[model samples]
Target: MSKEIRKFCHGAAVAAMVGLTALSASAEVSLNVATVDAAGTLRNLAGNRLHTLLREQDAGVQVRHIEGPVLGNAAQVRDQVAEGSVDIIGTDIAWAAPYSNFLKATSFSFVFRDQEHLAGVLDSAMMAELIDEIAAEQGVRILGAAVLPSRAFFTKVTPQRAADFEGLKIRSPQLDNWLESYKAIGANPTPVNWNEVFLALQTGLVDGAHGLPVDVQPNNWHKAAPNVTDLEDMFGVHVWMINETRWSGMSSADQATLVAAIDEVDAWMTATAEAESLSTIASLLDQGGGVFITHNAAKREAVAALAGADKVVAFPEDEREAMRNKALAAGKALEGQATWWAPGVLDELQSVR
Candidate 1:
């Protein structure tokens, strides 16, 4: 929704909620939510689902999902929430990492074994304590986190082996850990804004883009970079953050209601992400846009024996491990630089089953 419409609706809600609260003090609570993705995408769906679930649990809770670029990018809207102008924001964990060392640790590659492992760590009491720390220090609290599919390269030229990626410019966000990890894998990691990635790929500003199928398919980046090399290295986590002050001022009952709604939506995202990714690839293939590449030795050899095998080659598993190690090392190194980092947090995460 546009900011003008949101303001009008919020103003209307205030008067209606005032009457409801007069009847019962805890009768209503209103939340102004922000998200960077456009309406109807998975990210937006999660926010809209939260609104539905919240209203079902408590009829008087008001939620306005302000879709972007109505507000700005993820970083800009996150500032809005921290400043208390917006109640909640849906953003990537990586975008929020600069504010919280614990979040920075989670943003690195190979930190979790897989989707189930990531989910377990996020749902644990340890993570809850870390989030509380963010609220206490950074003014924003992560309510819940959900996984997206594993990320890899969507390249103009299919990389037949790990060596093929060497010295090639790969587009990624300008983040220390991500840049360092890609460097370890031998790619000359290039920083590019997400919105500008299509132009970057089309103009050969970067030889390939790094992201998931869902991310590339919607933007038709696959049309520019038709080869998808599924290194299956790391997954993306979408986090819901709320302003700590706003949360603290809310009635305990209202806080519980919002948390319950987020919990359900997190579950839904985790359950559906994998299927959505597969469906995305199927559609990409049907549209003559994607050529899936795998790293399994047998599959690689089998595809290589075919007529156009170069389009379906593999990235060495050893290279993927090297990237993972570099990311873990980078995450560990943060403890010395950031005073708020807990020494054993990385160990604790790895220890989770």
Candidate 2:
């Protein structure tokens, strides 16, 4: 969480605490809101925002915030939500892919043009159908989703061309799509748990890691591998979901309140992400500890906008196009092998404006 959000959520929590305490004895709804990320992360802040909203919206409703991995990791917490052990959770949409493989499509790098494109598909009828299917099949209801910081390549050495990535070891989660994304670029994708990425990089266990600047900064991985390639290839979706049983048990008005609260959280998340993206890059450059590289024109423009274009290393245009072509081909091929998605689902997502 940024200072701005931390301050706002802190004040909101204080005010909400007073309001909820006044009605503590008579509160009607008690929700166990959980998130796996640490206190300063976007997902954690979303959980805080939800708690604050529920309290301010209804004095009769009480929300218990579990802000860290006290319960478990992302997959474990998501499972808890389905099992009703956790009332609500904020985590990666990809963690829910085991219940519905259609969600895997969203994890493919370069699959969506940008945040607006992803958000459009999230709100589209197709996504609604997918969510409803999950609710009925896996007993989880997705309330809303926010775009996570885009995953970029943070390496020890900057690659100036497509072939420069050949045989490079990139640490990644074991997700099939994500690993395949790195493999598609001719890079050797190694499945390393996120918690181990920093050590893995430090010890030369991997040549690079694919992740967000926010993650790199907080974990201080930049100190280990200071070269960053901002492919902006893929972005993760941080979803707010509730146990289907819990959702169904709620009064219709309470359900509406939950959804409305999440909508505001989502809006705040989108705005925060946009501003944070630029500031993170600026911070990285200001520290003079990392070399940031990108071939994307828009990303270059963004660096220029921040007046840090001089600090960004440019990847060759031809190499970028070649890499893009290969990545697209690989994404399409992976979709063909994954039979879980409804026929034509990928097409529908791509067609979304």
Candidate 3:
């Protein structure tokens, strides 16, 4: 062959290879993440970390975060994700019930002993299967559970006993069993959306609200209520989810990378959330603007008595037993798994006790 012809063929081969490589890289997937937390909060940490990890995994992959109520409340975000209007969302199980009745199982109060128990349950095969089943039905995918501590009641008035809650109106999301539980104790439970909670308290429309100290303190609920009662209620298990249609459209390699990124973000979120809740509570008390009250031992006993012998009678007999059994079984199955947080976060969670 002539020297000029040989050089021309070599250059064409190089150009073809470079073009294929560029095409493959450009095929990377992109997703949008939405959360209820505003700027500079631990709640945004999970989404932020996942976004970073996804980028690191694939240089071409992109994740855009929409924080605060930019996409409406958590419930609205979930609906948007389901309808494919949003690519991803972070929301709690309570919000999932609107999309799937099976999620009702995860809403059972006190079903988990602590964050570790809840983590174990989510990581279990049975729970994973259930989540997948629900996700398929709802047109979304459960990436994993975001770690948050148990919620407590913050009030302006100090309660000497459970009976002290009598006639006081408390703010809560509308959940029938939860309402019934509060009503059974003589307190009037009122449903209020998160956006309206601050006003509800400021106007004395509600005397108290239930939330994690870290969650409420960041918003300065202490300024409105001035008193917080560590009435350990339910642990909040928020799920990181993505629209199934968007997820299914991703390349297999990109999907694997995305899942791994979510796992790392979840671990970071769990550690940060638990630490922040405790630290915020201390900060609030130190500010001297609010008083932190421990539940009266006798009053706590009375509340437990009302809950019944199972220590989780807030639900019907069959339901309560089923939750306990599932949690215990999940704990046993995850006994030595490093991902399960051995000795359990249950011990660390007792600090709030």
Candidate 4:
């Protein structure tokens, strides 16, 4: 979503949203929601679904889903929401780092047992309130849950052994979660912007790529880095936000109704994305794009061992320990509330806890 020049639909955006500053009780509550992904993308579909759910909250609630660069890039939308110009927007959790310490803890290696484990922690009421309390200061409130699913690695050359990734340049975001993971695997981590990822891979600036399958599919990264050896190093979660002023204007009954609907939409979106992501790999191969490199039990063990043995280089040892402890405690607390977990995911959660 961040890779190219923005084409904002200025007039179209303004047309879609009905401003809500001073509305009569006879009028509906208007939500001006924005997303950076184009229509048909997972997050966009999720946002659209969110719109449908919000309207169902009450006859008084109405939603407008303005997508793409119509609201500027994701960062601009964040600012607009803070200033109360936009009512809602969706973005990655990286944006929440400064808002919550628990979010900072998400970067630690092995913090999540698996995809569902990661979702469980993020959807828990504790984390939800923590994010809301922190972000409320900025005039934005965390609305609900969003899972971008887990991220994987792909390369131009296949790695037969785990250590084969050593010294290779792997493209990732500049966050410690990504940089330190690749460094632990012995790769030279290259921080690259989202839009420039295709260029880096095609030009060989980076030998391997890291991102969710949904992310790389539309960007056509599979064509450049064709050897996909799955290594789910971390969870890719998104943060849903709404302007605090808008939320505050609503009555208590209205707020409760909207929150419940948002939570339901979040669960549906996460499940849909998970199913679609699994199908993306097959389509990539059908299109003559990449071979799936299977990492057998031994190779998988080797990868786990490497990450487990990875030293705390990006963060101070004491801070790393604190993050891990907080992360685990958060996960443990969410175990019971993970009703949306896929089959057998709870068992995995048990092992992690």
Cα displacement (Å) at residue 135, model 4: 3.1
**CA lDDT, every model vs. true structure:** 0.68, 0.71, 0.59, 0.59
In angstroms, the error of model 2 at 120 is 1.9
Global Cα RMSD, each model:
8.7, 8.2, 15.3, 12.2
Question: TM-score: which candidate is best?
Answer: 2
For model 4, residues 1-353, the per-residue Cα lDDT tens digits are: 11000110011111112332433455567888887765666677777887877766455677788976677767677889889899988767665554543354354344566677666555433343344454457877776656656676677876655456778898866666456555655678898776678889999999988776776777777888865565444667665778877877875545555666666776776777677665665555445355554323443344334332221012233433443454444344443342211233323433432
Ranking by TM-score: 2, 1, 3, 4
Predicted candidate 2 versus true structure: per-residue lDDT over 153-265, tens digit per residue: 77888789899889999997767766777888889999886667889999999998877676556666677887778776788677777898877666555555566677788
lDDT measured at residue 319 in model 3 versus the true structure, 0 to 100: 35
Q: Global CA lDDT of candidate 1, please? A: 0.68
Kindly indicate the candidate among 1 and 2 with the higher lDDT: 2
| TM-score of every candidate relative to the true structure | 0.81, 0.85, 0.72, 0.70
Give Cα distance to truth, residue 347, candidate 4, Å.
19
Against the correct fold, how does model 1 do in TM-score?
A: 0.81
Count the clashes in each prediction: 0, 1, 0, 1
| Model 1 Cα lDDT, one tens digit per residue, 126-177 | 4544555567788987776777777767887777665777888988787776
- Misplaced by over 4 Å in model 1 are 1-27, 56-58, 296-319, 322-335, 338-348
lDDT of 1 at 342: 65
